[model samples]
Target: MTERQILLVKNSWSYVIVKSEEAGQLFYHRLFEIAPELKSLFKSEPKGQSRKLINMVTLMVSKLQKLDEIQGEIKSLATRHHKYGVDPAYYRIVGAAFLWTLQQGLKDKWNEELEEAWVDMYAVISNAMIKNQQAVAA
Candidate 1:
């Protein structure tokens, strides 16, 4: 993607940054709706897990444009996620929930380009996460 496209994606995500709480809520709600089984990974209560879920997303969104700068942190996060039983497939589910939440939350503001941006961002983030897990396993 061109720098303009990158900027577009970053700008679109900027809107999400302002509404981080709502965005995280939407993401976790959609995630649990799709994968109720994963709920067992969280504690008996959902509040703490929910906070963690949202906080992670919020951090990811805040750093989306600076992937290289935060690679180490992302790797650490991926490792922690693994300890919680998160696998690559769980990344897919999280991505789906993330995109769905953005689309539903943003409504008309979302378009093909924005969708592509989000997809690309998720790919980069998830790949780094998976790679980190693989490295640890190796």
Candidate 2:
């Protein structure tokens, strides 16, 4: 998938539209199911963490259409995540959970096109975050 196709998915309401109180809980549940050990890192109430996740993701997606404008914000987020000890593998976990949520959220509408769009989009965003993290390390 091209970057444009990826952006089409990112700018969609797929993330924010389906974003609900229950969605967060479901995300955590699915996340733990895939990566049980990561559960220990979230030392807060599930609801609180889920809210944070929802808000953070919403903000990120909202800014995706203007990535150049949000470069600093993205860098800051990546830096903070680094301090939190979030590595590439952890990103994979979150991405997987996110995709699962969309799949469940969109149901029949969730086609291979959407899946590829999300995968490509994740690669773009994750690489940007990694680059930002590396820049900070340098």
Candidate 3:
């Protein structure tokens, strides 16, 4: 990612993280709305799962610049997710729901640049996850 995009992601995330719990709940709600079938994949209670989601994504975003350090973690997450029965195609739906949740949280601050930066980041993360899933399958 470009420095500008990295900056955009960091800056925009600050706004959302302030209400991390709410944002996390919103994301799950949106995710379920988009793909109701996915609801069964989650084993944790809603609030707990919401907190976990925020925590994991927070760790992932915080280490974005040093992704080399987290590649193993990310791939392992993918492998665990694969075992949980997450379809690879569901990543795109998750991305959409995530962006929508961001838009809802960021409100006036959300824009093309921010959206693009997130799309770029999500693409990288999800592609890695999907690739790792494939590797694990093989």
Clashes of each: 0, 0, 0
* Stretches of candidate 1 exceeding 4 Å from the true structure: 44-65
- Look at candidate 3 and tell me the lDDT of residue 55: 83
Preferred candidate (TM-score higher): 2 or 3: 3
lDDT (0 to 1) per candidate: 0.76, 0.77, 0.92
lDDT of 3: 0.92
lDDT of 1 by residue, 1-138 (tens): 446566766677678767766776677678889998877776645556656765665577666657677878888987887888777788888788888988987888999988987788778778889999878766
TM-score, one value per model = 0.84, 0.82, 0.97
Model 2 weakest 10-residue run by lDDT: 10-19
Off by over 4 Å in 3: none
- Candidate 3 TM-score versus the reference: 0.97
Shift of residue 65 alpha carbon in model 3, Å: 1.2
RMSD for each model, in Å, please?
Answer: 2.3, 2.5, 0.8
* Residue 72 local lDDT, model 3: 88
Highest lDDT against the true fold, candidate: 3
Per-residue C-alpha lDDT of model 3 across residues 5-118, encoded as one tens digit per residue: 988998888888999999999999999998999999999999999888888788778888988889989888989998998889999999999999999999999999899999
Q: After superposition, how far is residue 88 of candidate 3 from its true place, in Å?
A: 0.6
